[model samples]
Target: MNILELRKKAVQLRKRTWELIYNHKNGHTGSDLSCTDILVALYYNVLNQTPETVGTLEADTYIQSKGHAVEIWYEVLADKGYIDRDDLEKGYSTFNSPYIGHPTTDVKGMEFHTGSLGHGLGLGVGVALAAKMNSLKKHTYVLMGDGEQAEGSIWEAAMAASNYNLDNLTAIIDHNDLQITGTTDSVMRSNPISNKYEAFGWNVIEVDGNDLAALIHVLTSENNTGKPRLIVANTVKGKGITVAENRADWHHKVPSQEEFEEGIRELDAQMEALNHE
Candidate 1:
């Protein structure tokens, strides 16, 4: 898909995210909105797996470290045909439902069951290492929240990725600048993120997280340095919605009926603007 198309889809994803949360009366709305563009870009434009072939060893892997945003992931997976839409709409976060609050391997397209913040990078590193050892051509992509970077295990995984020279692995940090508590800067600043990753011996790239062209370019870029790559994606907390944008309270708050309508309107405006552009 073209960049413009991906942008439109991202707007749609943002709308769907709000709808899902509003209907279910639950979700990590702000965080989900923050990363929707990246998710859309990856699933629609980058990743090389299908609903039918997601289990194959050669398929590209995507792990969500910030697993609270699994609602968006489920939506994307369903939209991508990795799972049925009926399952996505009906089976969400219920007993015996493959769709849960966090990702699980039980889900057909989920590469890992991730909810714990710091463990995803470690898992991605391990997957990348195993693929390297087997001389497999697959790449592992891991998405993390900026707040989760505070964990010690993340650093440990970073160190290991560098040590192993896992160039086939890419880690994208959703630097929305807000955690559940407060602003990431005020709570625990993770600034100079790119330099820190570079210092840790990984190739670092920073970009607007909501820009589909930039994300696609970075994802497909050559990394001959033989180190893991980290993309620090600067993003707004509640990206497509006016009220939720940069608001910490929306971190996991479900929108009211009025708020949900307003959020969709904002997304529609965004989509229209992008279409004209």
Candidate 2:
């Protein structure tokens, strides 16, 4: 898809996501909105895996380490036909529903169960390492939260990725800078993450994560450096809706009826504008 197409899909997903969260009365609202673009770009453009292609050892792998934002992921997967759209919209976050707040192996598109914050990169490293040993062409992409950087285990995984020279591994940090409690700056000082990754032998690249074109370029770039690549995606905590953008309180909070309406209007305007563009 072109940039405009990707942008429209993102807005559409955001509209559905707002409905899901507002109606269900659950979700990491800010976190889900913040990473929607990146997820959209991947599912629509970068990833070679599809509903039929996923699960094979040789297929491209995507792991949502920042799994609290699973609502957006579920929407993208549904849109891509990896999972049933109606099943997700109807059963999400309800009793006996498999569409929980985090990614689970029970889900059609999920490769690993995630939500424990700092374990995703390690799992990706393991997959990439195995792929390398088998001389497979698969690439493993892990999307992690900036707040998750505080976990010591993530660093250990970083070291392992480097040590193995896993060029097929790509780790993306959704650096929205806010957590459930407050700003990541105040909760834990994990800034200068790029330089830290560089020291760990990762080819660090920083970009406006909310920018679809930029994300596509960086995500699709070749890694000639023979090291794992890391993208520091600078993004707002709540990206699409003006009322929630950068608001720490919105991290895991449900929107009031008034706020939900306002957000839907904003996303609708965005979709219309993209059509004109």
Candidate 3:
């Protein structure tokens, strides 16, 4: 899909996720919204994997380290034919549903069970190393939250990735600047993300996380520097919904009925404007 088409698809993805969250009465709303575009760009444009190709040696691997935001991933996977829409919207967060709050291997497109926050990059490095050892050309991408960066494990994995010169590994930090409690900086400052990654001997790029074109260009680029790449996606928390935008309470908060309706209306208006464009 072209960039414009991808943008429209992203808007639709967010709309669907919001509805699912509302119906299910649980979700990490702000985190989900913040990473929706990143997920869309990866699933629809960058990753060389499909529902059928997933788990195969030839398929690229994706791990959502910040697993609380699995709603966005679930919506993208369903749209890409990984899971059924009915099952996702209905069975999500229910008793014994694989569609839990975090990424689970039972889900068709999910590569790993991640929700432990700081462990995703380590897993990604392991996968990338394994692929390299097996002579497989698969790339491993790990999506992490900025708040998760505080964990020492992330830096350990970063050091290992650079030590191995795993150029095929890319880590995307959803720099939404907000976490469950409050602003990431106020909670635990993790600023100068790009420089920190670069200091770890990784190639670093920063871009607006909501911009489809920029994400596509950097993520799909082949300019590997014999080192792992880190894309710090600067994003707004609760991105598309006005009421929740940059609000920390929306991190794991379920929206009120009125908030849900207003969110849908706002997303619909955005979609309409995109269609006209």
Candidate 4:
């Protein structure tokens, strides 16, 4: 898909995100909205894996380390033919549903059950190292929330990734800067994120996470430096929605019917503007 098409899809994802949360009456709304563009860029335009390749060792792997935002991931997986869209919309977060609050292997595209913060990078390192050990041409990409960066294990994985020189490994931080209680700055101060990763001997690239064109360009860029890659994606929590944008309370707050309708209208306007552009 072209950049314009991806942009439109992102808007749709944002709207769908709201719908899912509104219907289910629970989700990491702000966090999910914040990273929709990153997920869209990776699944639709960047990753070398498809629904078929996703199950094989030869395919690139992705893990949502910040798993509370699994709603958006589920949507992307369904769109990519990895899961049934009807099943997702109906069974998500329901009792006995595979679509729990986090990414799970029971879902067709998920490689691991993630929801416990800070373990994703470590898992990605293991996968990347295994690929190297077997001489496989696979990449491991892990998406993390900036709030989750407060966990010490992420740094440990960073150090290991650099020590092993895992060029096929990539970590994309959804640096929306908002957590459940407050701003990431006020919560844990993981600022200077790029410098922190660079100090750990990884290649760091910062970009506007919501910009699909920019995300696609950066995510698809070639890497020959033999170093692990980190993209600090600065984003707005609850991005593309007027009321929830950058608001901390929307972290897990479900929107009322009016708010949901308003959010959809706002996304529609953005999509229309992008279409014209």
Instruction: Tell me the TM-score of each prediction against the true structure.
Output: 0.96, 0.99, 0.98, 0.98
Residue 12 C-alpha lDDT in model 3:
94
Quantify all predictions' global Cα lDDT against the true fold.
0.89, 0.93, 0.92, 0.92
User: Against the true structure, candidate 1 has what lDDT?
Assistant: 0.89
Off by over 4 Å in 1: none
**Regions of model 4 farther than 4 Å from truth:** none
> Which residues of candidate 2, in runs, are more than 4 Å off?
none
Candidate 1 vs candidate 4: the lDDT winner is: 4
Would you give me the overall lDDT of model 2?
A: 0.93
Give lDDT: candidate 1, residue 122: 98
Task: Put down candidate 2 lDDT per residue, 1-277, tens digits, no spaces.
Answer: 9999999999999999889999899999999999999998889999879888898987899999988999999998899898898999899989988999999999999999999989999999999999999999999999999999999999999999999999999999999999888888899989988999999999999999999999999988899899999999999988999989999899988999999999989998988888888
What is the number of backbone collisions in each predicted candidate, taken in the order shown? 0, 0, 0, 0
* Candidate 3 Cα deviation (angstroms), residue 87: 1.0
Candidate 3 lDDT score at position 8? 93
Error of 2 at 173 (Å): 0.4
